[model samples]
Target: MKVLQNYIKATNTHNFEEVRKSLHPNAVYFFSDQTCTTHEEIQAYFENGWSIVQEESYQAKNVNWLYSGSDSATCTYTYFYEGYIDGKTISGRGRATNIFVKESDEWLLIHEHLSPLPK
Candidate 1:
């Protein structure tokens, strides 16, 4: 969906405000190490990640929409990320699930869960 694409673009910008524009007010995020249920927590988590991973670029691959309705949609994808961490180049792939809902005639990301891919 366009919203999902926009969200990914926003993330690449590494600007929290731009990213926040794509999220629902009450959005929740599940990361490999922690869960964020509040906007403040989510913002902190994203900022911290960006700080650690300089010039990080993230992408979603093989996205499959598990469910799509008039008001809501859910999708799963392989997420790839690469960047420099502590002056060393690092890259990884993970599994991601995102849930979005239509609100005020626009789609907003409500929930996202990301986990490390299995060996």
Candidate 2:
């Protein structure tokens, strides 16, 4: 869905309102070092740590919509990403699974789990 692309771009660019547009009110986001399950928690995560990321890109590989119902969809994909952190360029790839729920006919991310592939 286009929303997915918007979500990625918004997060990479640290566009607060744009990113929030794609997330559910109670969406849950999982990070390598922490988890966010509430609006406040997620917002804080983005405002604090996520905002520090200056350049980031997330590309989906072998993406599959495992289940697509009238109101929900489950997607599994490999996310290849690279970015700069504190002036040092770093890169990593990971697997991403997410649940998108339709609200008023628009899909919003309800749950997301992302983990890096082993070295």
Candidate 3:
């Protein structure tokens, strides 16, 4: 979905509002480092620590819709993350999965799980 692509872009750019536009009213964002679940908390976290410094390379490995029901869909994808931050090049590869629900015929993200690459 185009909206899903936009969401990914918004996340890479750290565009919180654009990201918010694609989220459900009651959305849950889960980070690998933090084991908490709350919209406001994650929003604050994003505001504080989410940023793409420079030379960031993000490529989607694959996207597959698991179950596309009349009112919802679940999608899973792998992302390759390589970038530079604070004058040091860093690489982070991970898998991201999300659940998108239709609200009044418009898709909105209801849940997300982002897991980091294994060492």
Candidate 2 versus truth, CA RMSD in Å, comes to 1.9
lDDT of 2 by residue, 1-119 (tens): 66667677777666568778888888999988899998778888777755565566667778788998889988888887777788987777798998999999889999989888767
List, residue by residue over 1-119, the lDDT tens digit for candidate 3. 66578777877766578777888888887778774366677677776655644656566668888888888888888877777788798876788888988889898888988898667
Clashing pairs in 1: none
The lDDT ranking, best first, is 1, 2, 3
Candidate with maximal lDDT: 1
Question: Which candidate would rank higher by TM-score, 1 or 2?
Answer: 1
- Of candidate 1, the 10-residue stretch with the lowest lDDT total is 1-10
Compared to the true structure, candidate 3 yields what TM-score? Answer: 0.81
RMSD per candidate (Å) reads 0.8, 1.9, 2.4
For candidate 1, write residues 1-119 as lDDT tens digits: 77789999999999999998989998999999999998899999999999999999999999999999999999999999999988999999999999999998989999999999888
lDDT of 1: 0.95
Query: Candidate 2 has which clashing residue pairs, if any?
Result: none
Q: Who wins the TM-score comparison?
A: 1
